[model samples]
Target: MQVEIGSNFWTYSLCEGRERKLWWESEEYSKIFLKSGRNAFKAICNYISADKRKVLFPAYHCGTESEPWYESDWEVEYYPIENNFTVDANKLKQCIIKAKPAVLVIQSYYGFDALNDECNALLQECRNKGIIIIEDITQSILSDIRHQAVDYYIASLRKFFAIPDGGVLISRQPIAIRKIAQGDNNIPLNAMQAYSLKREYFETKNKGIKEEFRAAYVVLNELISVNDNNYAMSDVSLKIWNSFDFTYIAQKRRENYRTLSEGLAKIDYLAITRTFDNDTTVPLFLPVLVKNNTLRQELQAFLAEKDIYCPIIWKKSPRIVDCPKETSAIYERILCFPIDQRYDKEDMLRIFNTVEKWNV
Candidate 1:
């Protein structure tokens, strides 16, 4: 059995007629049109006046890839939590009171759940304090809070869908976006490469050959450019969204997550992140926190040998703040296992069996 776990594949494949149209309409908001990924981030930065001098407080425990894009001076104040990693309201309040940030960025980790009460309170406090709140919906798009409580919200469309490059930014305030003057309709080599890479990824999966899948990824990564202009929000992305069925994709993701969680329950030292009460999310990945650093790496290698790719989702480290040394150390132990729509019961059983065998 082979399991593919590099990224979240788009769920548009599951929908029919009017239901598909509804998905696109649901994402649009009054005065705010969804802009492409990085462009949306740029627009928010401009609206919030977040330059290189102002400080932003991001939850330190969250993913690090997006923090630098803020292009502003920043400090990180992580929310305190117990063994289960729930957001700590009191600690969060204290941090907000002390840091007095201009903007607060929050993330729903692993899409495991939506914003907890503590998280909601923090957003309210930020609002009362007149600070901007940028919600990262990259992992938690299924949560209702994406439409509520944020001055601005951003999500990577490419992460959730099969499309090459796209991100949507929804805002409460209206602003004029200067449309780019179209001249050349030439598709950039990089965008074409990424498109090809995604095709190859799925192709290898269908073939049931794990080694070929890895090779496809290597080629895909090489051809893909992280900073290419062609992949910027284009007609192709919007067309893809219009044609796909997001609801079906969301349902499949939730179903797959449940199946994997149930199958892996008996494994010791492997605990999945629990969703918060009254919150729903299309869980992006199933993260299992192991007991020790050695076990984490060993499990990763064991899975890889079987062509089951498991990766470390987040490596906790200090942001540009004077955080306590102990907090920085937790970065080494978290591992994320695959739970997307691509894996079936047979594939899940293969993963679980690998873990059980490695228990000794």
Candidate 2:
């Protein structure tokens, strides 16, 4: 197996000479009707007339998914969460009633829990108030949490799968739309390269080789960074992404996350995310809050030296907003460890051992 470190240390075997297959076969991949000028998020925005009058009430703690969508015409407001990252349901309700936002965004952090009844009730209330709810399922996938409740649901498929770039936006109400012609002619080479490398890595797994695969991954990430143009979905890449058995991947991820949580539970300084009430999530990564900022950075650096890639998933504040003091404080202490299907028990042990050694 090959090993490397960055946002998270990942290990994989190679799949150099294998039969080609679709990523998902039995189940239909979520259909995305793509228009030339608009992406999934833009489509959702158009549905809500967000460009005309956009207002987002994002929960304080989340990744960059909610920040980039804010436009000049749109006013973004952050609602505070308690020490545990759970929003105050009453406060959320009160804020929505008062602000009358155009859209309310909710992120299922770490995919460990679903929206609690209180949160759902608040979402329902917002719906009744004619406010749209956009669920960010970037981190949550398998719990079968119905998206029917929300006006629009979105997820960045890359975070969950091995594919390089894909964002899914599903809406219940069909708005006037247009599909981009297949030969629109502006495919980003860099993005396509990343997607290609990711495919290579996935295919090569289990070939009893790892070093070349790791090198390819590094190159792929570099390409992704340099490519500024948005990567539009290609027919081939979409087919590959949809071919993988999602059920197997999700089950493996869930089991791996549970193993990591149990193995590292004794680390007092690390505060892992607990399952939220009512919601069931497919855990993406095992996020921990270190005792202090120094420890967080030190551990990160130490892990990097060992080629153990741990990624800090999101920036603290992408823009100027009066974020809660608690959220800001926790952001400084948080780090995410790999707990996806790509890892196993030995991988978990290695991570735990590394952390324990550093604790000395």
lDDT for each residue of candidate 1 in 207-300, tens digit (9 for 90 to 100): 5443443455455434332332223455554566556655766676677667677767777777765743442567777777777788888888
**Tens digits of per-residue lDDT for model 2 on 1-360?**
235422322322233322433222114334453321125555555456643365555545443454346532466676665545566777777767677677787766677544568887777877876777887666665555554458776766666655543556665554454543342222234345444554455466443334554565566555433322334555443554546665666676676677777867888888876743442456777788788888888888898887677777555666745667767765777788887777667777788788877753
**Candidate 1 residue 142 C-alpha distance from true site, Å:** 2.2
lDDT of each: 0.56, 0.59
Instruction: Kindly give the stretch of ten consecutive residues in candidate 2 with the minimal lDDT sum.
Output: 5-14
Q: C-alpha displacement of 252 in model 2, angstroms?
A: 1.9
Candidate whose lDDT is highest: 2
Candidate 1 positional error at 131, Å:
1.2
TM-scores, one per candidate:
0.77, 0.78
